[model samples]
Structures are given as structure tokens and as C-alpha cells.
Target: SCAVALEAVRDEAGLGRTVAQVRSERERLTAQLRGHGWRVLPSEANFILARSSRSVWLRDALAGLGIAVRDFPGNEHLADALRITCPANETDFARLTHAIDAALAPEAVLLDLDGVLADVSRSYRRAIVETAAAYGVEITAQDIARAKALGNANNDWILTQRLLAQRGIDRPLAEVTERFERIYQGTDDNPGLRMTETLIGDRAALERLRARTRLAIVTGRPRFDAQRFLEEQGIADCFEQVIALEDGPSKPDPAPVRCALERMGVSRAWMVGDTPDDMRSARAAGVVPVGIPAPNDTREEAERTLFASGAARVLRSLDELLEVLPS
Candidate 1:
């Protein structure tokens, strides 16, 4: 898939290559495809879908020979063609050729963001503290830990208000909310406040996975904020689609997961994250849930929680994810 290949290129290049080189390479590839007697279709994308005018039905032909290809339910234009991928290596390209000739179909791959792609908890915690302080109310570390542990649900706001009430600190809810907004907007107040952590092992594993699979970002963080972080990390283009909290309902609810699947045009996918909420969300959406327990979490506790929450598999580190995902 061009999506997958481009992700690899981006990861390797980090958005520093010249536009001319990129364009020239694309043109050269197009010419080569044309030379092969392939009726290359116009693509604003990295890959192309092609069909032979010959009697063979591309999908059926691929299937008859035991190969799989991506097919959308309602797109007529793509209905008869095989979605070919641009493989990153000679071995991969050779495999692709064999699969194409043998007519094998391809499987759709989905990726999870947040804990799977970045560490966002630290940034989120700082935001919570700063937001509370902006309201002229100081919240104890206990409160922050409680809210985060309780799924960070919007209902926490009500609990916060109650806590303030008990403290004899009366403030309008709207005023308090406005202060929270200000803190979120003023991200520079804490230069190090980031929800995502750069785990080198995870980043490398993700880069390897992107070489073949169509990746998506399904996260509980708001879309705008998530995008900002992804762009900052130079990995925004790695994902074909991103489904964030603001895109739909929160986790433990199926809406956001479903939204991610819809955007990625995938039915089956693996949902990976650290929290039980992530597992519950995947279950609600009918997807496989994989848990990557926090390294700092005690092994017994992580195992207990992940198993109790119905994780299909528990990974101790991001590097382990590569073992499960397709190379």
C-alpha cells in the first residue's frame, strides 16, 4: 500500500527531503509502471489500483489464486481492481509480485495511537493541575491521581466542583471551566507538559510496522491536541486516519472506535493501549484489545488489571508489539 510505504519514507526522511526529488521519483515510478503495460490510473496517492481489461476479474482472479486485496464495500471504481502496494524492499517487492501473480487478497491493518504511539499521561496530568490553578483553586496531587485513575471522565468536573464546595471555595462552574480552557491554550506555561512520551523502542517498532500496514490513530485525547503532538513528533503523516476523543464519544463507549474503523475503511482491527478503558472500548466496538502495560507498573498489578479487563495479549514493551503485528 502506498499509505504504508509513504509512512516508511516519512519515518526515514523526517520531512526533510526536497520536493523536487520526491516529485521526480514519483514521476519515474509512474513511467516504469506504464512501461510494464499496466494501465496506471491517476492517483493523488502513493499507490494505484489497476485492472486488466482482459477477461480476468481482478478480485476474483486474486482470490482464485489465494491472494487477498483491499476492497471497499461501496466504491464502484475500485470494485474491479487489485490495490497494489509499493513495497519498501526487494524481498517485499518479490513477495508482492508472487502474491499478485498468485492472486492473494490483502488484509486491512489498523493502528492505535495514544499509549500505543505516544506517552500522553504526563502532559495530561500537568494540564489538569495548571487548569485547576487557573481557576484560583489549588487541587492536591491526590485529586489529580484520583481523577486520572477514575478514567478521567467528564463527570470528574462535577466531583471537582463538589470538592471546591466542601472547601468553602465557591466559584461559578463556567468561570472554572474558562480557566481550564486558558491553561490548555497556554501550553507554553509548562514547556515540558506533554501527554505523549518518546519511547525509542516503540517508535522503532511502529516504523517497522508502518512498512506494511495501514495505520490509524484511535485515541481518547482531543483531535486538535493529538494532531499538534503528532506533528510535533514528526509522525502525523504515518497515520492514514486519526480518531480522537473530540471526534466522537469517550472510551468504554464504542463510538470513537467505530469512527476510527470507518475513517480507516477497515472492519477488523487491533486496539492497543495501557488502560482498561482502552480494552473496554475495543470490546464495545468488536475489535481485538491488546494491552501494553506501563513499565513502571508492578508486574502483578499490571497482569491482574489487564487480564481482568479482557486484554487478548499483554505486552511489556512496544518492541513486543512488532512480534504480534505483521512485518
Candidate 2:
């Protein structure tokens, strides 16, 4: 068959044309990868080897997206490299690079659990208030808002501890957390404040948004809490992945957001959250940061903190993201 095919295009003109086209695409792909910060090596063959820390991960991610790239994970010298074969035409080449972009950049929607997905005013916020009162510190909603604006209060337990400290009531973190979780999760015989939670956006609307883009959770909640909330809300399947507290450092550190993106196997994404910490994390992870009003914050305060922390847009409702997402 190889001999027959060669004979069919045996003419020097046809052979030269094919060789020129392949060489052109190979050069184009190399240039494109280099422009995107990939350390692409000079190639005289059918594929280009590009060095990236994401080489192993990208190989797997692209495979999931139905594209193939070779990674030399077992080779000491090439373990950090991916060898991408050049596509034969401009259209396929365009597709190849687009997939690469999606893997290397934010391409999905990452969500914050407490404020954005579930209305936590009656749940987590109430837990904070009740827990502080137990420690003899009467912190108001405004105080919580102020604390959140600091961009390091993603952990409600820690926030409660800090609020107590501000009131001259320095409580042990373990003690404060014990009380906070008890109130939030409740005992087997008692209903917890978590029951007060409700979905911020309608199920149908979320489904619509999910249909339009990939969805995932990047929350400060422990994996158990996050999972329970999603399951109880009957929306567990809406997101592709969940990056919980156990995954890494909480919001404002960018670790959780990046973990979520990496788990989803795409780099580019938009993150919708309500706290300054959420905005900062998304921005640091190179994801578009969109903000919604925190349950305990006034619109003015929400706007001020969210924007200052790097929110590209502040939305009135989660559903508004459908309007904001690019078509």
C-alpha cells in the first residue's frame, strides 16, 4: 500500500508540495507554542518537543479532550516535555492549538460553595454569629463583612476565632471550631443550621449554565461538608469536580482554584465567588474572577471588596453568568 500510494503521487511536483506543507505546519506549531511560553525545541521532524512542567498532566488532559500528544514521563531528560505532532492542515492545526490553550489557560467555571452556590446567611453566617456569642463576643454581620474584606478569612472557623480575639475574648481555635461545627452540622438528634441553606440559583438555571460550560467547586468547606451540601441540594452532578479544603490552602492562596482547574484537566476557567478571598484566589490562578454579593454583605460593601480584590465583574445573581460568558 505504501508503494502504491507513493507511485500515485510519484511526480516531483506533488511530492515537493506535500513536503512544503508539512514543514510549514511544523514551523507554525513550534512558533505558536513558543509564543504561549512553552520552551519549544527546534524540530526537523514530524513533531515538536515542548518543555513545560505540565507535560505529564497536559498529555493526559489533551487525551481526555480527544487529542493526542506524546509525553516522555519515563525518560529522565524528556520527562518534563511533550512531543506534539503537527496537524496536516490549517484547520486541524488551529484545533490542536486551541486544545492546548484550553489546557494551559482557564476554560471552565469554578465556583465557591458557601456564598455563591448555597445561601449561607442562615447557615455558615449564622454559625459564625452563634459561635462568637458562645465565646462571649457579639460580632455583627458588618464585622463578618469587614473580616471577609481582608481576603484571608475563607475559613469560617478561623474567622470566628479572629472576631472573638478582636472583642478581647481570645478563645482556643480548637474550641471555637468545635462550637462552630456543632452549630453548622448539628448532632444526630438536632437539626443543624445547614438545613437553612438554599440554592442561590434555580436548578434549571444552573443546568443551563452547566450545559454552556464546564462547572466545578472550589470551596473552603471540608470535602465531607461540600459533598453533603451538593448531595442534599440534589445538584451533585452539576459540577465536574470539587476542590475542597482538604485539597490545599483555602481561597486567596490560589492553590484550591488551581487544583480544581487541574482536576478538571483544563487551565482556562472563570470563577464565581462572593468573598474577596474568592476573587483573589481566582485571579491568582489566572482564572477570570466574577463576584456575587456575599449573603452577609451590603451591595455597596460587596462591590467595594470584590472589585478591589480583583473581580472582573460583580453579578447580582449566579444566573447572570450565563449572560456574561462569551458565546
Candidate 3:
């Protein structure tokens, strides 16, 4: 995900701009990791796991500093590494830097790309709008709002039908779908589209975390799209594993998660995401579920819903998860 953000930063925000404007700040952090002499990993999660030099004894060092980084037992490949969640702000970064300086030895890192890297909403919204336009129907903000109210199931088709109906052009469902495909293909790169501010922190956090762990991207997004996004960001080399939707069933189903765990040789692992689906998916896969609330969701509502749905715990932020997990 950070790789996606870095690409977005260069593509949308131009070069050499600090305070990355996009919701995901992958580019900023990627720059930082490269500067720090760490071999950054590709990621799909908001956090990353970096492996320090064997000489450094990173695990013992962090433990000595009173900072606990996530390390799952039973995964030999990941045993010597530390998993770090991306911080949301500059102040958090400062603390993270301090911790890194104290704990790690300069070395290669592993990273996840999900929450820590890309801010997907803006791209997703633009993709939706473009898809709608392909069907010869004009979608308005209200139409989008209505679609959102219905959740992911109704997002594409419902909005397309409503817009077409508003135009007094009732077409067959097949034709509408065909048109949607056409529009989406053409308008996917509209310059006006962008992710929200909440996503900006992802990239920045990844770069910093890279200075510490080995990274991989384990996501429910299809492999084709995920790879394209990473290539665009110029950080594809950072990750060793690029697990995508086709790799297995989508989240809330244990297939993909278990597949990732198997590939990474990770027996004990932490799953982080904004929705209850993330937590549920992790639990279903028998991994630890770390819930990071959506920016728009109420804290109390998130906790109640996630906890009721069987989350091990609900976190206010990614940084909080770092605090709760065993070092």
C-alpha cells in the first residue's frame, strides 16, 4: 500500500513536496526508508515487519527500550524481526524514530501494504464514478451517497441504474453493465480523483517501519490491480510476497489469510484493518485481529460493533495496536 501511495505522490502531488497531501503518505516514507539504509518490503497492511542486522539483536534492543514491537511465535522466518505499525502524525514519527535509533541495527526490512501504504478510497471512488460514466449515465454526489448507504453490495449497480433512470433512459441491465465497463476503462485516470486525508499517513509510516522489518503485501484486492498499483508507485521491489484476492477467497473468509500465513511461514500473526470484516477474517483464519477504526466511524460504535462481532480487541489507531501487542 505504501508503494501505491508513493506512486500517487509522484503522480498526483509532484516531486519533492514534504507533508504528502494525499490520504496515504507512502512516497514520503519510502523516501525515508531508502535514506535510512533499510531494504524496504512491499506491503498491503498499514504496518510492516523489518528484520534488523543479525549483529544488532533488534528484538532484545526494543525490549530494552521499553517499546514492544509485534513478533509472532512459530513463524521462523519472522521470528527475528519486529512488526511496526505506521504512526499517523509527525509527533508519532518522532517517537518511532527515537525507538528505532535505540533498538535496531541498520539492515533489510519487510513491509505490509494495506493500511500502512495506500489510501484506496479516493482511487476506489474515482474508479466507481468512471465505471458509472461508461454506461452513459451521469452520477451525482447524492447518487454516490445513496450507494454508500447500501454498503459494498449496491455500490456499482444501484448507482448506475438510478442515474440512468434519472435521465429517462431505461436500458436493459446487460446494456447498462456493458456501458459501465466502457466508461470505467476510459475515465479511470481522471485527474480530479484523489484519496482523503486519512490515507496520507500510510506511506510515511511504511517508510519508517521499513527501517525495522521484512515486508509483504497480503490483501484481498485482486493480484492484477494490486501489482499495477505497486508498479505505478515504484516500490514493487520492496515486497517479497504480493498476495492478492485471487490468491484465495476474500476477507471474512479464511482462505486468503491462511494462504498468506502459509506462504510467509507465519503461524502466529496479527491482522490489522479498518472494518469489522478485517477482524472477522483474521479470527476466521485463527490469527490475531487488530481493529483500526475507520476515520468516519464513531469510536464507541466501532468498539461495540467489532467486539460484538468477535474481535479480540478494537484499537483507536494503528499506533495503539503496537502498544497492545507483545513485543
RMSD of each: 18.1, 14.4, 20.5
Of 1 and 2, the candidate ranking higher by lDDT: 2
lDDT of 2 by residue, 99-158 (tens): 666555546888888888898888888899999878777888777878888879999999
What C-alpha lDDT do the candidate models reach, one value each? 0.57, 0.80, 0.52
lDDT of 3 by residue, 1-327 (tens): 999887867774353333342224444444454454555566655566565343133343333333355876687776555566665566656555554542332222222244435554444444556656665656654455444433232224444666567677676767765655444334456433322313425455555444444456666555775687677666676666787766765655766667766777655455665555565665565455555555444567666665554555555554554443323
After superposing candidate 3 on the true structure, give the runs of residues whose Cα lies further than 4 Å from its correct spot. 1-116, 129-199, 202-204, 207-214, 234-238, 295-303
TM-scores for every predicted model? 0.56, 0.68, 0.48
Model 3 scores a TM of 0.48
Candidate 1, residues 1-327: lDDT per residue as tens digits? 999778867775644443334444445545654554456676645455665442133443333223355655576765445555454344544444543422222234444555556654454444556656655668765565444344534323444555566567777777655655455454455444553355334455667667756678777666786788778788777778878766877776878778877877766566676667777776566566667755444556666675566566677765665554433
Best by TM-score: 2
Q: Could you tell me which residue pairs clash in candidate 2? A: 105-267, 105-268, 106-267, 106-268, 106-269, 107-268, 107-269, 108-269
Q: What is the clash count of model 1?
A: 16
- The segments of candidate 1 whose C-alpha lies over 4 angstroms from its true place after superposition are 1-112, 133-174, 187-192, 195-202, 295-299
Give me the runs in candidate 2 sitting further than 4 Å from their true place.
1-106
